[model samples]
Target: MNDIDAWVWWLVGAAALGIPLVVTAMPEFGMFAVGAVAGAIVAGLGFGAVAQVLVFIVVSVALIAVVRPIAARHSAQRPQLATGVDALRGKQAVVLERVDGSGGRIKLAGEIWSARALDSDRTYEVGQAVDVVEIEGATAIVI
Candidate 1:
């Protein structure tokens, strides 16, 4: 195909790649779409098909190599605020029943929860406050 025709085809391919990126919300496809656009640009500048393909490959691979890990690292970061059962840890609760190592009950986060003292011998009387140390199954380990 002629240079203009090849560039148009490349631009069409870039648009095709972009559609999936939008639909799937996948960053990789977006990166590839960018590479395709780069290839189109090179083709418009009168480069051969081989050179255009090389540009596409290099751009896509470079983007994946450089951006993917950075994206992954950012995504893998721990949230500033805890959530769900994790948020319960380190929170204070009020003893609803006498809390001992074996078993008891506490009013925690607006719900009643089965609880046990972190220290085997420790006990918390009703109305006393305790800190949730961990959760095991349906039970809360507290201190």
Candidate 2:
């Protein structure tokens, strides 16, 4: 331990941290790897062991604090994008069959979907264009 160079250890640590980043695809491991590389630079510059460790800790913590929140914000932005049936709402559909209160069919977003009129008494004839009001189960409610 005394004979081996501290910079070598730091480089090894950096490689260790990088493995998890590759395997798990977690950005934090990459941040830690960068920190380890910073520590290696300090060690290669002939800094003392304590100073090298301190540099590693400060770099790692700073990177995590600064970058984690930004990453979280970007990831959280996904909810603003609609998906699945939620995406179907407010989209236009063409009635493939007479749509009434009971049940019918419509071509929605290039796919066939079971449909029902938004108003119980209102009926839509075949080829009529209607707006999807909402999705209930596998059916699209339209007007």
Candidate 3:
């Protein structure tokens, strides 16, 4: 044991930490592995055991403190893409038939869709442009 260098021990610890990182997909373990590498570097440079351990702790904590916030911010963001009916909301549609509260037809997003006026009393004539307000079942509510 005495013949094996301290750097070898640090590298072994880094490999041990990497196992859980791969299995669990946890970034913290990878950070710790990086810290172990830093410790290995310090040991290879002839630093004492305490100095190597201190470097490992400092590197790991710094990586977590700085990287975690950035990672969280990225993960918390919502993609701007709206798909399916959600993409139709607030879009313009042309009345294909007389559209009123009772329902008619409209050309929306290059497709003919069942549509109705948001205001029951409001009517749209054929070829008139209307804004789609929402989707209820297979119908587009417009105004």
Clashes of each: 0, 0, 0
Candidate 1: clashing pairs of residues: none
Candidate 1 Cα errors over 4 Å, as ranges: 1-4, 15-29, 45-54, 78-81
**How much does candidate 1 score in TM-score?**
0.73
Q: Write the per-residue lDDT of candidate 2 for residues 1-143, one digit (tens) a residue.
A: 88989899999999999999999999999999999999999999999989998999999999999999999998878687799998889999999999999999999999999999989999999999999999999999999
Please list the C-alpha lDDT of all candidates, in the order they appear.
0.95, 0.95, 0.96
> Can you give the TM-score per candidate against the true fold?
0.73, 0.74, 0.90
Give candidate 3 regions above 4 Å deviation.
Answer: none
Q: Output the TM-score of candidate 3.
A: 0.90
- The parts of candidate 2 lying over 4 Å away from their true place are 18-29, 79-87
Ranking by TM-score: 3, 2, 1
Best by lDDT: 3
